[model samples]
Target: MPTAAGHRAITTASMLTAEGGLELRPRLSEIPAHVGVIMDGNGRWAASRGLPRIEGHRRGLEALRETVRAAIDFGLDYLTVYSFSMENWNRPIEEVTDLMGLLKRFIRNDLKDLHKAGVKVRVIGARDNLKPDIRALLVEAEDMTRANTGLTLIVAFNYGSRQEIAAAARALAEDVLAGRVKASDIDETLLAQRLDTAGLPDPDLIIRTSGEQRLSNFLMWQAAYSEFVFLPMHWPDFDRRAFASALHVFSERERRFGGVTARGQADKVKS
Candidate 1:
């Protein structure tokens, strides 16, 4: 074994080496390459402050912008945020209308900015559920940012993981009926490739703000072994520091993938 001074010298040399070319910041080990965020607490945030829920939604959108930027800065590849859900339609029609309007406005304002920032924006859900104008805008925004390569910002609109899975099932059934594929060959990989996030990687982390511990129908099929971080703070209040803290938590754990370990690794496990 090397002596203490000799080990220090080797460590110093490794840090000084340009073997990995160059990086602006020290490498962050175990950073979540794919992060799923359940953007919650807009209504509660508004009610807590005696503000309109629409205002809360508005603030939430701005916060999402910051989140997108933060994820890019942290070198996250896929950032999926639950923007709208099928259950959200149960809310008041006026509030729903405003939410749809907010969606349109976000598309109009941020689509260009996202494209410019090299972020790929994708709307994952049933486009047919939206109004004509909103659908058109969603289509336009999706097309504009489709070719981008930096970050994949998936906005789940009118989305639910159960619905997504059901849709996939229907698709598979159709293919089977048409004699295009065998029913027995329908495995997880085949199903995954048919989902809306076909070409994307599975999420490594699923974060929920507003102290919620539930999945709320967000990526249920994909989050099988994902690491979760819950925050009591609302979505509008969750910032970069919170994101960094989650990364730090993720980095500190060992991801053994259900393997048996020796004496040096019994305290923590992450996936």
Candidate 2:
């Protein structure tokens, strides 16, 4: 297996084609620094196979393991996965209990391997009402890998974009009331600093599996400028190849960030 340093070296060397033209195809060096995934369709995947929904969720966990390996091999800096959402509490009690069990199992089984690989673990989301055991597991995962310098695996479990944003706003309001900050001084940067994702770079690309075409309450504020790639396959079917395909699509896009590109600028002048 290539070390992360070896991957970086390969990416640097392949930035251009032999003819000195721009490399059009996806390059390892061009992979986004941060990628977010909305893991969806686990139930659908299980249903298609005439299996229990929990079975699909189990397979999805395996896919997540594969994704983490690929991210490290590709030299990605951050990979944020939407593991569970605040809305998921509405699920049947048995299904919810199963999901919680899976979470505990994943942490217990994978934490050591992840730590050995120098991956830092960070869990984002509301945790105030979680069961004691589950909360402890989350803390353990983050604490065990806090000092690793390689890929940061951010799990958005029990998270919701609206709730996150609202909490940030409420915190800011409290500060203002206490005179720690003034209402007039708050801005996008100030508000973002209070978010669960503070100190993290905004995701450069967001991928959704299961043919989903919307944000579905994940990262609303942070994804303002992020490019999206929706895949037709279920979350259980996502592999390194599917991941690479998303990167290829992102590489071919012209991200203007709401500003005009050079080509567009020239066209505007001509007009």
Candidate 3:
């Protein structure tokens, strides 16, 4: 775990910044390395079409497939999606069951293609409460794609950011009690290392569909400085074009973190 000085902010080549009124711009290749998405509005999409909610979810899967391919084509290294949340269990039992069935079917039907495409599967969520068969399927997906070197697909199934953070805290506390670590030594980097997304870089950009404007507990900590794009279309309508547009928006913005950029400095001087 590195201190703030040592924790270098992840940077892509050719990024634009405001410096002394000079336009500092990034190159076309300076795309985000990691992207997170809140796959929303599936039920709404289906309802509008006079179809079952499950149909929308099924269509959403198709959109997800396209997004995966698009991400790879765009040269992104990682993509995390909110597949399911712990709160989703509050839905009717039938809806929950349908979602679980969809999850099982998707993995069984798509795992081979994902492996063939060299995608690495990573599941980030609670597993103990899941049905045995579903848990087994998730494990199988991860094992089959473990060795692949291409895009890493993180599925946040049965996940909740607050729960994840609490779990990390508990783990750290246990470590302290066992004399494996000192409470005084805990820091952002150390705590992050204990998160489900330990090895992965924080998302540079997060996109939510159906015009939503909220985190919904998805990657709450990891998105501290992430740029967000809210799309009007539902998850099922997301496509390569929409993805490209989001990237374009990301490219046009400046990521200043906590400091004033050169442009800001210039503006202050002029004022």
Candidate 4:
């Protein structure tokens, strides 16, 4: 964690071109390997414009397409997005139907392009109760892109972090009961391995749009030390510049990961 003055200094030193121009994009070395996004504000954006909420969601899908391309361009190893949460089922039936339709459309329309771009599709969340068609589409997306080795696009569909954690715990308990392992064998590592995001690295940065500052039940277990960047713009308004700005903000932070930095050590000695 950097002090305010230190943050400003780092920003100034790292975000300047050799010719003294402002560089909005973060350097490649400063980029995080994984990023998770909580896309928000589609409904509010639609309401503000006096349009149907579905219209905003449609625009948000477009934003997601651009974001995937941008993430690939940025050389990010993994990009996770909170697409549809389990709680979203509580919305009006029509709205929920529209969202499901959008998911189908996105896969049917963009899956080929995604596979062609070398993006591996991975879906996380409980799928046992999903509609058969929806489940099949999810399976299709992953199967189509499983061999791609470029960017891994993790879609958190029908996801809730609490439920995910609880499910992991339950699975571990079942394994213990089955004599697969002793109670002492269970630890953070074992528990995390049972999680939906078992093989993926924890997100290094989590970005939320629509001015929201909370995780909203997204990636609670994995976001233990992730840097968050909350943007005021709605999900429909996100683009390359917005993504770049978040990366730039991330670049200025000092992630000590619970350890003391040299500056902190020096300040402690002086004090």
Strongest candidate by TM-score: 4
Tens-place lDDT per residue, model 4, 105-147, is 9999999999999999999999999999999999999999999
TM-score of each: 0.85, 0.90, 0.88, 0.91
Instruction: Give the CA lDDT, 0 to 100, for residue 223 in model 3.
Output: 93
CA RMSD (A), model 2: 6.3
Cα error of candidate 4 at position 145, Å: 0.8
Better of 2 and 3 by lDDT: 2
Worst 10 residues of 3 by lDDT: 1-10
Candidate 1 backbone clash number = 0
Q: List, residue by residue over 191-261, the lDDT tens digit for candidate 2.
A: 99999999998888899999989999999999988889999999999987788768777666766777777
Candidate 1: misplaced stretches above 4 Å? 1-30, 261-271
Point out the higher-scoring one by TM-score: 3 or 4: 4
Over all chains combined, what TM-score does candidate 3 have? 0.88
Residue 249: error of model 4 in Å? 0.5
What order do candidates take by TM-score, descending? 4, 2, 3, 1
Global lDDT of each candidate? 0.79, 0.88, 0.87, 0.89
Higher-TM-score candidate of 1 and 3: 3
After superposition, the stretches of candidate 2 with alpha carbons farther than 4 Å from their true spots are 1-26, 269-271
